[model samples]
Target: MPQKTNLNYWIDYWNRTNPASDLMDEESLVSFWDKRSEDFADKIATAGGRKRSRENIALLEASGFCAEGARVLDIGCGAGSLSLPLARAGAEVTSFDISPGMLAQVQRVADREGLSVTTIAGSWWTANIDRLGFREKFDLVISSMTPAIKDAETLERMITCSRASCFYIGSFPGGRDAILSDLLSRIGKIPSPRRPPMGFLFPFMYLYLKGYRPEVTFSRRRWNETLDTKKAAAHAIDIISHDQTVTPAMNRAIQRYYKETAVDGKCIFKNEMFLGMMVWKVRP
Candidate 1:
């Protein structure tokens, strides 16, 4: 029997936690992102949010991979957060996402600005990379802070498709989500007492083993979200259901919590976030 690699360990851990098949199927997943598109667009349009996009591009360029004329692939690009900015910076970008609604947001901007962005809608998990001509076809491939890149297969897909470089950014566990925290405790899902796993570590270590010394960096910020209370409540229930069987009582409790906290039908969730990023040039 072969020994398990770091990638195997990470995949096992991700499967245990995410349960992608059980939680959401293709249609429901698309609907999920479609519903969140409006809210995602609103937040990413904000000053702070826009600044974050600029910062990501700047960091990527700082690693010596210039966006100008680069063939860029942004996986799970929600509302074109990085895709739009990168396109504006002269990259010929392919903005790939699962939601037609979210891709429409990118298409709108591309039409208005005539930026070189091609929006494609499909699940990363279901994408046929070879048939799509994606393997080693990009100068840079990015999978940043997306649940889609949970397993080794997804992580390796980035590597197989990139000729020049790859950048990945993912969240650190144990952030402060005011409403989620309360609802979690109410439903008997208090956060683990043990220390949480470091974000992006497994991916970074995996890349290192494959002979790339990725530049790893950590960032912390506060995200202030303005959510549609009704939609947000339903979404929260969907999230809660993934971890535990959401009983009818638990569902109502989540809804009631959202209603009580919302002001004028909008819920503002303020939370601090810590993220880890790794960038590496593809070795010859």
Candidate 2:
């Protein structure tokens, strides 16, 4: 038997760790995000989110991928975190998301700002570069903290669509999620089968082994939010359902918990997350 190359090894590791079945099917995933699109748009427009977007935009500008007339493709661009900024920076921005609801957020903002951003609705998992006329057509290709870029094929498609540059962001190993745990606990006997997907480790290693010198940055931060009981209930259900089935009773239980426990119709949410990002020139 032949020894596996490091690239293959990492790809295999990613596959074994984050299997497709563990993720929501396309329809469920789409519906889940669609329901939360309004909340997501609001979150990504916050001061902290703007700051983060600026940081990402700065990275692209510093790397010479974000500039006047540059063609940029932002995959899984939730509420135009980077796309809007890139458009403002004078790049030709194309924002793609699996959920039409999410894309609507981008378009709304773009219209308000008088910025031009083309919106595409499709799942990256099934996107065909050739048919989409995307092969080597973009100056920069990027995805931030999205399950869309799951494995070798998805990663390769980013490169296939890009002339040179790419940026990717993924989760780190551990963080605080008391809010999530508490939400599931409200669902009585239904447990949160929360498994942290093997994150940037395998993909980063895979890129490195393929002879790409990727510049990586790690970020850790804590965020807090207060939402109405009803919205909080919806949020919790969407999150819990992503990893495991949330029965109708479980959903009602979550809602009831919020309704009864909320003070002045509001519930508090807190989370601390660690994330990693990488930028590289795929064809340089």
Candidate 3:
């Protein structure tokens, strides 16, 4: 369990923030790729495939969300990270996103692989559900590292549309193991208020409120990367300089941390974190 004090505070703060803020908007979401997309795309395209892809697929399978001849809806499916793999596994997939650039990329991948997928270009929050004609038409609805309908109304909308199950991915707030916190603290900046583990909490609370017992699983992945320390430091500098809250002094401090942490011209960076997934059947 996460610290209640910090978790609640963050959740409250996030709730008060604009639900449709740029962070949640499609354009803002894709803008995250502006700096690293080309490099990242090459890395991903060349890495053969991500190891995390298999892990995610396994998690979904264990939860009874198999891809064998089932229909799956991936909201906020950026560049077909999961969608492509699912399609290859023989599932009919519909991926929706807010960025035309991302959708274009997804199309290119699908076309290259000769895989057919329905692509929707729209904001998840404002998408016309009726226009899609997919109400209660999917076996699984998934949102990875993206916000789920936070409030009850949106939750109901998502549930009503999910025929069998829904899966949400959210960060665990205020965990001592948060990688983002470590990165920020190196710059003498206080971490942002921790938000509720909506990915885990939303489905749990939704099931609880509806008189059902949901099965919950907590999981974590440690990503270790070997990067040339000098290059890594430069990249970190670029990232912090662009952040809204980082100051010049803070940036220098972070640079120093990166310098000190480097070993033998390379650094092995590790991200320790927690996440949860919940699943429950909708009563007939």
Candidate 4:
């Protein structure tokens, strides 16, 4: 028997720890983003946001994936950050997201910019690809920092929807938001004695094992955020306390941390984020 690779172990651990994730329930996922739609769009418009977008777009352009008139499908495209740019570049862009609020924002931005983009509100995991005739229908498929690509089946399905190529952006191993980390530590939510494998490494290894030569690039950028105390506490709770209800104790801990950490009447947090951009061609 072959030894279990880190990717396999991490997948097994994630499935066990996050059981509901495999179901790919649209409501659960959609609701999470719905609450975050506005803030998410705002973040993308920030200096860090523009830098990340430009880097990813530059990578795509260099790869020849964003050729004029290319049919592009951006899965989990929130607020048209990338979709609108692709549309403006003359690609026929179909952007899909789980949040109607996000799709609405995408539409709003696209309309304001006079760029045409089709926005679909649905989950890629549960969407009927064939019924929608999206199977192998796109020249380029892009998923950036989206939770939709969680497993092998989902990743394969994403590839199936593309005719030419795919690009995925994921956090590098051990990546953590600085604010969330400090808050979680204050709240006594440290990892177990044994740290699990990094989530990003698995997909890259999985693709390699499947004979796909994915071109990998690493980008590091400093992301700084300033939020009011209440917003800061809420954001920290959301990121660190996933699936677990925030009890009064947790809330108090977050509030106290925010009060202690606030600088100049605002909660200021900064982190150098490491991201991996992976791209590969799909055989017809």
Candidate 5:
């Protein structure tokens, strides 16, 4: 029988074999996110509070990621989508994002909810962790749906910032479903290229290279969301398109889907379930 591959060994091997990724710099990434912040905020805040944002928080809690009076750091915390929930759960959350605009929205929500959260606007790569004024620093470092260390230097930096555990949730290669592919095809646009599996494997490998055996967990969630009006359906389409090119045929197809799938003027759309893996270990 073939030997079962140790997850950490595979991770390290993949990282060493893969070429460097050309991910955008922090400024460019933040700019892209800033431009879409409002749409994301609307979708998340109005998605009935049980979707990706909430699911991420639930997963963290289930994993024992944070505790009462513990300090948590939410990197790339877009508009407090995840930070607010952590704060409400009794952790002292420091929400950091590269975009000031994104941080502004997070602050507004935190202020309105009477939640005490400290917001930092800077690239995690360059942020002075010492200036944050936390005595003992974070027990949990969490980043949801953000780039998980595009380069080796950033990877080391992320590890350096975490006091106990670091959790990174990102899309897996070949994880897209037929539904999303169909939607993309209707618009005559090629699906975004898949990231090399090494993107995920490397982090796990890094831990092994450092002589730690990390605990890894994988999970997925699937569901359909209903948009109750043509406007809502259009908004959904726009969100997916990112205000980029949407051919007329694609628009018609969306309209047809809206008409056919909708009930009582509500449109139903399905998103492919995303699979995420969490790799963690106690501080060495």
Candidate 6:
């Protein structure tokens, strides 16, 4: 017989994988992404970005959330990867993010494409959906790889805010580049083997126990990016030390790795990661 896990066990496991960080505090998280807004915008314009966006949109269509004239809310809609395409598809998209910089980029693209996407700046964890008229307002709600979907309460809120369906995508632990993994190990911080996808398992199981049948899809893709040595080094630093200052030794190691990997004026890093998608219809 299969073992049954309790709710507390799943919640605790999920929390362990997603540790709270002062650096990831609401204000700090906003500031961190505000600085990377432009770079992220450029990334989403690349081939890999288009690939992921295409798949996400396809899933939405398959899940019956891509109806025309549908009101969609994209939580943590960074750089409009999903929002822009949906807007162009004729959906009324309301894209929300904690960083104003990200929202600005989304609006900028929306204007250029002649697609109207309403952008809002706020953190889902602390935002009042009722005050913002988001309570049960959207035909489709999406929270893709966002820190906002942290617990059961948040998951319930996401479903409650949508009239029809809610779609979510999140990491599956082993989804980082091997180069970054090596660097982290060299620095004595070995990556955890516990997959981040396990984080999504809790919600899926919890929903099932609540008598809701959630449809799920699993996807794995290798992300490849080539950047100049400087950019590569900066990216490594950001990943290795989220909010902490990179020590001299760590910086030296990162630069050396980038220097060795650079070819034709670019440093390339390729890594495979898993993404889990869950879609639940809120109303029949």
TM-scores for every predicted model: 0.84, 0.91, 0.72, 0.86, 0.69, 0.87
Candidate 5: pairs in clash: 12-205
> How much is 159 displaced in model 5, in angstroms?
2.1
The 10-residue segment of model 6 with minimum total lDDT is 189-198
The superposed Cα distance between candidate 3 and the true structure at residue 214, in angstroms, equals 3.6
lDDT tens digits by residue: candidate 1, 1-284: 23347546656776676555444566766876787788778878889889999888878878998878899999989898899988998999999988899999888988999999998888887788998889999999998777567566777887889998989997776678655765566556434222112257667766765667888888998877677777777767665554457777767777887788779999877888888888888882
- Predicted model with the maximum TM-score: 2
RMSD of each: 4.0, 2.5, 5.7, 3.8, 5.5, 3.4
lDDT at residue 81 of model 3 (Cα atoms): 73
Q: Candidate 6 at 59: error in angstroms?
A: 1.5
Candidate 5 segments exceeding 4 Å error? 1-21, 46-48, 51-66, 128-136, 177-180, 187-199, 225-268
Judging by lDDT, tell me the better candidate of 2 and 4.
2
Best by lDDT: 2
Q: After superposition, how far is residue 237 of candidate 4 from its true place, in Å?
A: 3.3
Considering only N, C-alpha and C atoms within 3 Å, which residue pairs clash in candidate 2?
none
Identify the runs in model 2 with alpha carbons over 4 angstroms from their true place. 1-4, 185-188, 193-198, 242-249
Compared with the true structure, model 1 gives a TM-score of: 0.84
lDDT scores of the candidates, listed in order: 0.78, 0.82, 0.64, 0.76, 0.64, 0.78
Q: Kindly report which residue stretches of model 1 are placed more than 4 angstroms away from their true locations once superposed.
A: 1-23, 186-199, 226-232, 241-248, 262-267
lDDT of 2 by residue, 1-284 (tens): 23356667778878887787777788887887798789889988899888888887777767766468889999998788888988888889899899999999999999999886999999999998899889999988988888788888888998889888999888886776655667666555766654434367767887887788888888897998888987777777767766677787777778888888788898877888898888999863
TM-score of 6: 0.87
Q: Pull out the clashing pairs in model 3.
A: 10-194
Local error of candidate 1 at 148, Å? 2.3
lDDT per residue as tens, model 6, 52-140? 88888998888766557989999889899999989989999999999999999999999998986899999888888889999999999
Pairs that collide in candidate 1 are: none
Clashes of 4: 0
lDDT of 4 by residue, 113-221 (tens): 8876998888776778898889999999988888777677678889999888999887775555776766666668633221212245657767776668887898777
